[model samples]
Structures are given as structure tokens and as C-alpha cells.
Target: MDTTQLLKGVLDLAVLAVLKDEDGYGYDILRRLRTAGLDEVGDASVYGTLRRLFQAGLLNTYVVPSEEGPHRKYYGLNAAGRDQLNRAGKTWRNFASTMDALLDERGVAA
Candidate 1:
């Protein structure tokens, strides 16, 4: 299966989940996702998702000065984002369960 296609459907959820634990700048978030095993995740995808989530009012953004280089904009979840993450997580769990059952049955029944 093409994991990129699968990731597209859940990018919002994945981003929200990443911010659930801590705030992160765009590159930091992208790195965290990659470190967590989503090596195929696109840099543009994470940047776009951060912009979208901020616009949607699910995330809060603030800029921090960097003595070494350019300033960094960090994103953190607000109340709406937490609510969204909770709902999306439940939905994902349900969908994954059904898919797992179907796949398991197919293997045994074949």
C-alpha cells in the first residue's frame, strides 16, 4: 500500500497529535514526526498543515527570537485543538479496529 496516500487522510490528526504533548516550530514538528517513524512525511506538508491549523483556531502561534539565526514560529494546541484531537483519535481507533478485523479475517479465511 501507498503510505503517503494513507497519511494524507490523517495528516491533520497526526499534526494535532504531535502538538498534544508540546509546542513546536514547523521544522521541529516535522522532525518529531519523522523521528516517530513517518520518514516519508513531506516538509511542505507539515508547513501547510501548521498554517491551516493556526488559521482554523486550533493552534496558537508565537515567534521566538534566535540569537544564532532567524526567529522561529512555534505552534501549540489550544482548547479547540485538544477537543479536535480527542474526537479524531476516537474516530481513528474505530476505523482501525474495523480494518484490522477485516484484514485478519481475510487472512484466516483464505
Candidate 2:
């Protein structure tokens, strides 16, 4: 399966989930996603997602200066973002369970 397509569908949810407990900048968020096993996630895609989420008012952003090169714009979940994350998480779990059961019935191996 082409996981990129899968990633496209769930990227928003994944991003929101990662930021639920902590805030991070673009590169940091991308790194966290990759470290969490989403190695195929593209930097551009993650950055774009962040922009869209911010524009949609689902995220809050603030700048923090960095000595390395430039100021970093960090993103964190607002109340709307947290609400979205919770709803999406439940939807994902139910969909996954349905798929798992369907595959099991077909005798597909995990």
C-alpha cells in the first residue's frame, strides 16, 4: 500500500496528537513524527499541514528566539484543536477496529 496516501488522510490528526502534550516548531514536529515511525512523512507536507491548521484556527503559534540561526515559530493546540484531536482519535479507533475485523474475517495475517 502507498502509505503516503494514508498519511495524507491522517496527517492532521497525527500532527494534532503529537502536539497535544507539547508544542513544537515545524522541523521539530516533523522530527517527532518521523521518530514516532512515520519516516515517509515529507517536510513540505508537514509544514503545509501546520500552516493550514493555523489558518483554520485549530492551532496557536508563537515565536521563540533561537541562538542557532533564527526565531522558531512554535505551534500548540488550542481548545478547538484539542476538541478536534479527541473526536478524530475516536473516529480513527473505530475505523481501525472495523478494518481489523474485516481483515480477520478474510483470514489476512497481521
Off by over 4 Å in 2: none
Q: Per-residue alpha-carbon lDDT of model 2 for 1-110, expressed as tens digits?
A: 88989999999999999999999999999999999999999999999999999999999999999999999999999999999999999999999999999999999999
Best by lDDT: 2
lDDT string, candidate 1, 1-110, tens digits: 58999998999999999999999999999999999888899999999999998999999999999998999999999999999999999999999999889989889553
Per-model TM against the reference: 0.95, 0.98
Choose the strongest candidate by TM-score: 2
In terms of lDDT, the poorest run of 10 residues in model 2 is 1-10
Candidate 2 lDDT score at position 105: 100
Mark the regions of model 1 whose C-alpha exceeds 4 Å error after superposition: 108-110
